[model samples]
Target chain A: MEQPILSIQNATKIFGGGFLSSSKPIVALDRFSLDVYESQSKIITIAGESGSGKTTLANMILGFTPCTEGKITFNGIDLNQMNGEQRSFYRQEVQAIFQDPYEVYNPFFRVAHIFDMITRHFKLARSKKEAQELIEEALNLVGMRGGEILEKYPHQLSGGQRQRVMVARAYMLRPKLIVADEPVSAVDASLRAMILDIMLRLRDTRHISFLYITHDLSTAYQISDLMYVLFQGTTVERGNTAKIIEDPRHPYVQELIDSIPVPNPKIKWNMNIKLPSEEVMRMKNTVGCRFYPRCPKRMDACTKAFPPMVKVSEEHEVACYLYQ
Target chain B: MAANEKILEVLDLHVQYFTPRGAVKAANAVNLYVKAGEIVGLVGESGCGKTTVAMAILQMVQPPGRIVKGEIRINGHNIVNLSEAELRKVRWRELALIPQGAMNSLNPVLRIREQMGDAIQAHEAISARDLKARVLSLLNDVGLPERVYNMYPHELSGGMKQRVCIAMAVALNPAIIIADEPTSALDVVVQRVVAQTLLDVKKRLGVSMIMIGHDMGLQAQMVDRVAVMYAGNMVEVGPVESIFAQPLHPYTQLLIESIPSIRERKPLKVTEGLTHDLRNPPTGCCFQFRCPRVEPRCLQAQPAMIEAGPEHLVSCIHYQAR
Candidate 1:
């Protein structure tokens, strides 16, 4: 079998823990693993609420932070052990799309400076004309015309247009994987569809796998192929997107799916449903299920230790003891 | 006031921002009303002037921007021409506001009790004991614990702080509360929780509300009526069910079609034209540049709001011709 393009094995990231400090260490991400194969390009969604460590996982994969344990390998090369040259290659192969498009650009420069910087750093083209061609082609991929946006300052473009330019910037790198963190959350409804459509088109045409990180499961359900539903930094459920959204098994996953406000007015949320306080929800259980405090179906067995992932179907796995 | 009585009415409102280049017509002849206890949603893209309209209602539009021509009536009293001192008397007691990014609205140094107390104390003459009781009850109404009263704003979570804002907005039981994107910043689960709190408070207090947001899904679930805005113009207004089920205006149709759904996956139907420059809007229709059903007549004159269905109003040349 061909090796996966990117593989993460038992990656753990714990923040602020040393011999000198008295405060307990916060486990941002605990033993998370995922794989993206080169043969098929896919949009894999890492979904969870705030502080569920979706961004932490993205940070580790993007080399923004190092894992406390385990390893992340890109095409069989461990990320931490990469030399300067290998690191550059990895950087080119992996790009990121942040949440706020407005803050990403420098206000002093024209929007074209983003593309010019990338091309200059990578030496993507030798001549000015060649560089222009590269930038135009990238813009075209995201359904934008370079002539309309290149000369304008960042403030001139709307939120949706700025985000599309960001997508074009990331695509220009020709990365194997794009880690998009809440790319569409800041845009409007119509433009959000456009950006998500661009991502779908990129996956099919460019063969670029995407690690889409978002708190919105509705959009994730629309585009992602595979999904990992995280609860307090632990993978509560992992499966095919359609399967998981259609038949979510874990208690936390079920609650999440139910909480999403459906667009149709005919479908209303159950108003009687109450969530636990933030204090209880954020309480960490070091030796047991993190969701135990808020889980309606929690039991004594759950508090004994963190449940292992058990296969519910060929492509679906859940970490609840009910499945055990 | 009676249930069907109009608690708040905005008629022929025009708000403009005078920039160095030109006057940006942020709200052009906008018209909307809220019946007692009704939750009317004002939704549009970022710069569609939804927030501007909310600020106009509160009489809070700052310099370079002003309510050029309009009449905002709360309980039959026009607030647009009211003096600063007169308006302050009408503000929290009659027409309150839960501003956008409400989590940051609270002073970080002040405890929730002191902050909420100040709003009440400014408008009323309650004793210290009575004020404390009133604040605690307000907190309880929003499902917040009593302990939250003494906690500083920084100590509360985002959801908690938002609930505090909601509690504060209802402190005086105002006739109408303008909530500007009340749940936009929170996570999905927490957003739903805050949304539910809003609904509960409205139902218990019988206060009318105007919710401003871009999230159609949340609007569908939370609001009684939905008003669609495009480029500083009111394009469509109808009951929430009818607006979602049978959107009339071209912009409304596109907006509804653009909302991504969780029930099933479908091809995204996005309209492709940028909103026209607000400073130099077209003569006939504000959405003519992007309207799929645009015609020459649409550019000849601005379409007036016509009755499209039972209690549904749409501003489009097609309906006007009919």
Candidate 2:
């Protein structure tokens, strides 16, 4: 029952504003927050569909974007108010691995640019020999040989290899927290397992915390210790990975779980599923319930006001009218 | 089954791309059969020749990639040696393809209905009224509303566009539908829906299928039989249950172990190295570098597909005998 290693208190982020903006400023993160304790497993899986604010939440945690409202504390260090020098150090403590590894590096340059970029800012290595050693060490951790990986252009490497190089670059800094956004979705299907395995090792071998953002729940199940299901920027359900998956409470959570392709032919097509009519855009963007329109189990109060995050159990939390 | 009744039979199929280092063998001597009214899955990792096999079957493998030496028999006719005019007759009517990137395969500038109509009319002598009826029914069959026909490809969502592509592929209800990563670009939920629709279509029409994908879970649900490809070779294959329950190949085990399953959270076993570059591969087993139980036998030569169980074959010299 010790305090979590990291915590976020009611974080909210909104993008775009103006007279023409009749649509609600897509609430990228609706008073969103989560906790990560170092003792337990070190992966926090953030899941959502296209419009879900999964990426926005991850960016705010990495301090890439300022939260429009709310507090983000990493080891109780407020991310919003950090000064330039402090921010640079924070950058070292927190690193990122983007979804597309090919895009992470330039096609023209050798993969070593990643190491060079860090050396200019931080004293990653004491000397030329140390620097080479450091780079090779990081590459080795990502399952790459330095002789081939460091010299090759991004175009020359496979999607999985490129991602490994990206992870290696991140490892070079020895960050306490890593924000990986859909890291393996672009890679070939066979190569996906390899990348996912590397990430699993990251948490176990190095004690690195990961804020994994992905829409694929199948792989998400494998990597996450704790999962927070996000729908349209609001937390639909948050609980232990196995518990929530086995018996999801919220209707939206159930639908997301049911939507996964099980390895059975008998469990076939689901019935007339009703997704929200795009007209939900016209629904009063109020504080009551963002999911009511799409929610299968709708209530009178659902459309009237926004739902509150109620604790269903010691570790389980859900934002729904039923709880209220 | 009649020997000639096979919708598609690929024999000694080899597809290679000429790279700077040398000819990269994208596909090896893969022999497969797609009979009537059943589905076969071609599963493997990125470099495993899954996509290459699909493209070569369609004769879409352009320069750098030559069919080189093989016999692709679609509906008992050899497509490999066919002329342009003869190949044209075989393109859409006899063999249909739902290519790797479903949405991207579509012509963005054109309307959904137009492509369907053109495909149908190009081969069969159907009237305009019949074409309209056929396109609408195709849309309905794939779970899309009939109204999707009027919309542009951009207007429809990713899932919707994929369904439209599937509709077009089976517009003629060709004997075989080769869906190459049809749902790869879509999300899990969308993928399930799309996959379900394909199953429904296959059952209703009694058409044979060659479903190609990377995800074993998805492949398990859709295909009755599986052919696991690795570095252009059909490394392992059998009934879906047997393949999952008793995998014979080390690479197959590595792939299965690597996947994070929802039902179980076992520690993932990562293959040590990267996929071999086909252009300059290690002159032995494609999986030897990363195999869990590498040995001297594995380095001698690539293992041929040998039957290890009932309809189960493995192409690995380092197979651990039970």
Candidate 3:
């Protein structure tokens, strides 16, 4: 079998268990694993609500934070053990697009400054003319023109335009994977489709895989080929995006899918549905299923110990006592 | 008092922000109304004047951004020209507002009881004991627990904080509630829960509401009627089902088509072209620059709202000719 491009095995990230601190260590992510192959580019969605550790997973993968347990390897090289040259290569191979496009930019600099910094740091271009050509090419790939946006300051461009420029900046690196954290959450609906379409185009044409992290399931459903539904940092369900959305196996996944208000008025949500209080939902359950407090079909065994991932179908897996 | 009676109405409303540059027309001749028990959704892209219209309806347009010309009639009373003292009498008692990002709207330093108490006492001279009863009942109406009364805003979750805002909005039992994206900040499950809380509260109180948001899916599920805005102009208004089923205006159509659906996957429909500058809007249609079915006549003069179907209004040259 061919090696995967990126592989995460039993990754665990716990924060704030310092020597002097009295607060309990918060398990932001626990026992999460995923594999992305280089042969086929895909948009893999890591979806969960805020504080559900989706961002923590993204941070771990981007090397912004270190995992307390397990290992993450890129092209057979462990991220934690990478040397100086390998670290720079990994940086060039993996680029990121953040949630707030406005905050990512220096308000004082022109939009072109972002691309220029990337070119100088990565040594992608030798001369000014070569750098200009590269920037234009990257912009054109994202369906934007360099002439209109390059000279303008970050404040001058709209949210959608700024996001597209970020995409173009990531594309200029010619990275294998783009970690986009809620790229379109701040953009409007009309322009949101444009950004998501760019992700799809990049996957199909350029073979640039994407780790699309978002809380928005609708857009994730529209673009992601694969999905991992996280519940308070634990992988409740991992499978094909369409199949999981259509027939969500885990109880948390079921609730999450039911919560999305359908666009058609004919299909209204059942108004009688009630959710448990946030306090109960956020209670630390070290040994039991994290969703046991809120799960509708929870059993006594669910509280005894955490359930392992059980194969639901050929390509789908769910971690639930009910499935077991 | 009767259902379907117009409880709140905005007639030819114009809100302008006078910056160093020419006046930025925020809401231009925008017309909207809310019936006694209906939820009218005001939706548009950012900077398209959804929030401006909400602020104008509340008579809270800030300095440098004045209500240039219009009448905001609440319960058949034109409060547009009312003095601050006179407006205060009508503000919360008749027209309550659940402002945008309502999670952060709550005072972190105050308990939920104190904050809600402030809202109630500001409008009514209620006894302390009675205020406690009213606040608890208001919390119950929004499906919040009684324990939340003693908890501070920071202790509660985003969804709970939003429900607290909803409870406060109904504290005065106002004739109308303007919820500006009440569930925009929460997660999907939590957003649904908050949305359901809003619906339950509305059903119980029978208060007319104007829901301002950009989530088309949410608007489809919650609102009785939908109003589409473009560059500060109300382009289309119709029944919720009709607006989703057969959106008339080019911009409205584009807005609906752009919604990403969960049931199926298809090529996204992208709307190109930038919104015209608000400081100097085009003489003709506000959406003419981005309208897919643009005609030469559309650039000649601004199209007036014409009835395209039963109670459906559209401002477009194509609809006008029809």
Candidate 4:
């Protein structure tokens, strides 16, 4: 039997804009929903530009912030109603990988201390010998040795090594899901592949779901099994990674896909690239669509009310007036 | 010197950082030249010495990190031996730098107009009225609105701030502009605009540019020529078209293959192992430890860069004619 490991239903995160506040409410995320099944481990990438609320969604998944409306549940347990014991267990089941590897670790402490804390906090080992064994196993999975990295400080290890250590720590916990927010964005080009490769291995071997968040479409297409294209807190497109990458539908998605500089020098970009307009659409007052102002194929009704998600295929759905 | 030839040239450049642990050879015997109105890309991963070469070109290499050997010539003048006072005259007027972080580059306490005034006044004796006009004209070239001139850095968006930096770089009408990861901090949409802005500046001013970036995709789009660096050495140099289509060096081949393209969906063929540590770099070839097609000679001696195709130079022992 298959059950959803994580389910987000109509999650909305609104910052400010109430009776007490004079500023307009900024809708960081609006009615976003997603699901991950435990029976099938996959990488679900949330792709968006800056201010597109991808980080907000990742923070929601990490349980750092509660959605103002709707709910997020892990293994049938709602986040808004979890007890202290349940919350602790939820923390153990879900781990996070951050963007900056340098900031993740404390410069004063030995790098091995992070893994030790993970094992002790999660109660993964009963004795010091068992903890050492677990640490070695996790390190081996990420192509690192406990002997080389154990006694070293954070500064001693390279950027790639520090990021791999984070992966190793996540592996030690045996988490059901890992939320990696721009995991390789700060790392160098040569090292990005190694970190991404580790994530793929974790998915294949450990059967763990990864909620990946990034602005880089190339990397998103490389690792994601499924992808969601967000535009200003709204899910404009969602489908299998290949289908979406091959043929993007929404105007925003199309622009984003076209904007990526191709590695082939033969194909040069013209000066015809579109810049995002500065026209602000007040969410509270306006309705047709959140992307109405910047959307290339926007209709008159697109400015009247929010557009609904329309089914394009069995595995694809897009929110736009074009399909309708 | 020939008319409009070689705006900037760096020959046998070597820069090293002397730390308490050891000497980190950041740039080793690098040779590069930028022709007038051409954009040459210096592509490499972090710590591969792309930025070091850019800094050394402008004599911006700080203490503990000095250029031990090199001839950096700007219009045939050896800038490497120029004094501080002599260098100042050629600094912004002949050579300019668009630094990495756009937001951090601006003074938070100062207004945009005041910052621009400082840069313009340092070079030429311009009045306040003339400075404003000059700054506005530069900003207009980058497609920035006049309102941004009076605003603080905090008031502008990341993309707008980057435009300000671009405007400031070309304020003195320098012949060469070295942009280090100009669009790395901006979003894809903003990056495209900033990139287009760079192209516009290059076209309008006819100033040669050395764009330092790790993204090969952006490099392919913007640069006329490409140079690939590994550990501190220039592993490959060639026309952008030739290098992208048929990379001769193993390191360049691996780098081009690693980039994830939107046009195709193939598993990234990643080369194993991390980059070499500068303090204890390997003899012969820096990429020998991680190269897939490394030969015995690769371990013993560093291969000299040999011409593989028209305008294409590669450094590898096992590269054969195709």
Candidate 5:
């Protein structure tokens, strides 16, 4: 049976505060919802271009930005209702691997400080000796050997090695879920595959769930089990990764997929979707479709009323007027 | 002196960077030839010394980076030993550079037209009217609308800005254009469009080009020949089909397998170890550590480029003489 590990409901995140805040809230996430199941919890890649609300949704999952409107419940513990201790416990279970591996570690601190972090917070090991053992085990899990790696500084390591170190740091806690934000973008092209392979192996061996966040759709399609298509802060499509990629239904989804460089040099593909107009910017205040301005098959009512998520099959759901 | 056939012939070029760590040899005795009107693709991963080789030929190395050995002959002139005064004549009118991350390439405060006009006027003694006409024509050739010339850099999209940069590069109609990572950041559709424009411009102007990029797949599309780089060294150089279809270097083979192609659905076989460190690059074969087919002798000495086949050169000792 498919068992859901976490279920997000009607989540909304609006950034900024005080007098500088604009009249219309910058809707980073608009009433988004999705269910992540344990059986197929290998990786759920949330990918989009910059300002596509991919990072905002990732922050909501990480508990960094509390959703303004709705709830994110992890194993039935409502994230909003949780107190400080409970939140910290939630963090231990759901670790975050942010982009820019250089920024993840403090420059002044030693590499061993990472182990100290897991020790001071989660009490991840049985004793000091056990903790050292665990750190070594985690380092080896990400394909880095123990003796040579831990003593080196982040600057001393290559981009790929440093990224792998971050993965190792996350492995130290054996967290059930990891929210990795563009983890491989900083690394070189050759090393990106190595890091991705490690993550996949971890999912199979350790039964860990991952919320892999990225803007590179090709890499996302390579790894993700389930995927979401977010455009300008709203979920346009969500379904099985293979199905959505093989035959994208939404116009935006099709466009994003078509934009990827294929190996074949002969075929020229333009998704043929036009950019949103000035009128669409004015219609940002409308109640209905956020993608109304750019949608190819848009109707009058689509601008007046928000479309509901229509189920295409048991595993697919699309939020578009055409589908509805 | 005619510029009739040969544009540049780089013979046994070697560049080394003297860091506090050690002397890292960037361009490990590379040799290449560019015809008067042809495109050669220099393909590799980032930090593979592709940029180092390009900069060394341009004589733009700062401290800690130097071209220790070899020759860079451009149009029968030894560029390696050219004085600063002699090289100034070749800057735009002879060969121009279209570097990566064009967002930083353009001047922010200046209008697009002014920036482009400045390049043309600096190189040629043309009237303002003639310069304007040339700038507008160049913009049209690169597929940018005439309005784009009037707008500032902030007003344009990434693709538009890159197109403008291309226009600026071709303003003087140089004999050779070294376009480094020209379409890496662009979306696939936009990348194709930009790449097509570049090819079209190169064809029309009859200018040779050195197109440098990080992926073998991307390079295969536009370039006639491909040169693979790894940790400041050229590992393989051959025709594009040979590089992709029958790669001689084990590293090149691994790279081909790793890219997610339209045909292959299986997860790519990622190279296990990280790239070689630039500061303390290993002796002998830089890729000796992670090579799946590494032999005992590979650890001891670097292999010279050997004839793998017709027009194919490889630097793997395993394929060389016993």
Candidate 6:
């Protein structure tokens, strides 16, 4: 494969975790690294619970937030050192789809205004006719017609329709990467498959890399090529989705997978759940392994220091003393 | 089935919402029942009237939305015909509702104990010491710490707040509890914990429950029987094992297949179109627009629920024609 199109090198983000703070600061992301190659389009998923720092990572990748340590590069160009022109170009190349489709647009404006603004700002088309043609083409790519969507307001469309319009706007820009944060969580389950299918088609036809962030392990396993499991603020496991989901080495990853309530009734769950104590969860000091309080298989060394990331295979990696 | 075994029953329940455009038939001839100490899962998409049916059960349907016709029998009393004063006594004491977004249902200014005490005092008179004991025991039952009784809603996490909601719903020992989307807003791990908490509370209190949610996986794990709804109509309902194993209704079959599975990777089976608009629903079947097995007869008249197997009922013309 060629050089990765986007690379996150040892990115560490600390919120108010600086010097001279009376309260304990939050370590949102700690020494996390990932790379997305543009050789062929693929999906990279970040999976975790509410406080696992997935959103923080998405914001950093979008350049809205900065990392305390390490760097993010696009096409071998450091994002932090980019000039104004370069930063604007980066914005055009990288787009995002947020969780709530209802809040994605301004309700007062017509839906087509969004596409018009994108084309005008990027200088993608010269005239009104050219911009209209471009908007229609992008809408068609997402299986929607222009006439049905152009003159309507945001409130008129359904949740699924609004989300597709957001996707169509991203398509209009011809971006190389799209970061979707729980895009289908608000939509009905019947429409989830369609949204996911559209995403898969985008990757295949457009050769556009996607940084899909969600807490749903099932959908991540279904569509992701690479998966990263985060606990607290650190990556506990990273590998091929099939291998990682089928044979999770990290204890937190295993629990997340097990808790996905299979649709089959025969596979009953063990009701005796082991939850982490609130004291260990709310502790301020950064001592040993962050998952030591909830890990089913804890070791003495795990408490002494954070475990080193070990290679399970050429593509699989885990951070735990047991794996070592 | 014996008369007393049926703790709650809704027969020919029709609820409509009169909008400026037209009268939306939110629920149409929906029939369901919950036996003593049994849990029934009501599964459907949004705008399918799952929540409307639940609201009708509690007699809390607001203006412009009324139960047009129905018999809601709870503990041998017809609640539909009861007076406001009579219904007030049966509201929380007989049928309790753990509403959607219940985590935020707690008052921000008051302590947790005050909220639970309000729920209990609204029904029956209890001494202050007894109320505290009851609140602590309910909190303990849901795996919450005793210290939470004094903390306000803002101090608790999302899962903790939901647990408090569950504790409040079952405080007065209601005969039936209706939990509408109880775990939809929670994380996956915390969702499972909350699901487990519901099961534990049900076992301890022996309260019949009607759980409304869109996730079939959680329903399969929790409910004793499953009821599938589409566009305000009951499509199919049966034992959980039987419904999941051999779903008769096409919509129900498609819904079960659409759920993504981590155990094995396969292409998801999605329904053809979006759910129908309630205001202008088709004259025949509620799911005819999205059903793959639609026929000429299906477009002419609605199919009645028929026994497909032992204790299994499905409302599809294809299944009924055979």
* Strongest candidate by DockQ: 3
Better structure of 3 and 4 per TM-score:
3
Query: Please, what are the lDDT tens digits per residue for candidate 5 over residues B123-197?
Result: 789998888899999999988778877989988767778888889889888878888889866755467567778
lDDT of 1 by residue, B199-220 (tens): 9999999999999998899999
Worst 10 residues of 2 chain A by lDDT: A273-282
What is the lDDT, from 0 to 100, of the residue B11 in candidate 4? 94
Q: Report the CAPRI category for model 2.
A: acceptable
lDDT tens digits, residue span B3-29, model 6: 349999999999999999999999999
Tens digit of lDDT per residue, candidate 6, span A1-324?
Answer: 589878999998989845787766789888899998877788989988988889999999999998889999998999999999999999988999999999979989999899888888899999889988999988988788999988999999999999999999998888999999999899888789888988998999999889899999899888888989888889999989999999998988988888888888898887777576567676733667888888888878888888889999878999989978
State TM-scores per candidate.
Answer: 0.98, 0.90, 0.98, 0.97, 0.89, 0.98
Q: DockQ for the candidate 2 complex?
A: 0.41
Interface C-alpha RMSD after superposing true interface residues, each candidate, one decimal: 1.2, 2.8, 1.1, 1.3, 3.3, 1.1
Candidate 4 Cα deviation (angstroms), residue B185 = 1.9
What pairs collide in candidate 1? none
Off by over 4 Å in 3: none
lDDT over C-alpha atoms for residue B105 of model 1: 92
Could you tell me which residue pairs clash in candidate 2? A287-A306, A288-A305, A288-A306, A288-A307, A289-A306
* Residue pairs with clashing backbones, model 3: none
Q: What is the lDDT of residue A228 in candidate 1?
A: 95
* Model 4 segments more than 4 A misplaced: A276-286, B1-4, B319-322
Give the per-residue lDDT of model 3 (tens digit) for A230-264.
98889989989998988899988888888888888
**Model 2 off-target regions past 4 Å?**
A1-7, A22-24, A35-41, A71-83, A188-207, A264-288, B1-4, B280-286, B293-301, B308-310, B316-322
List runs of model 1 lying over 4 Å from the truth.
none
Task: Order candidates by DockQ, high to low.
Answer: 3, 1, 6, 4, 2, 5
Per-prediction RMSD in angstroms?
A: 1.1, 3.3, 1.3, 1.8, 3.4, 1.5
User: Candidate 6, residue B154: CA error in Å?
Assistant: 1.9
The runs of at least 3 residues in candidate 6 whose Cα sits more than 4 Å from the true structure, single-residue gaps closed, are A17-20, B1-4
Give the per-residue lDDT of model 2 (tens digit) for A125-192.
77889999888888888777899878778888777888888888888898888889999888865567
Worst 10 residues of 6 chain B by lDDT: B268-277
lDDT of each: 0.92, 0.80, 0.90, 0.88, 0.78, 0.89
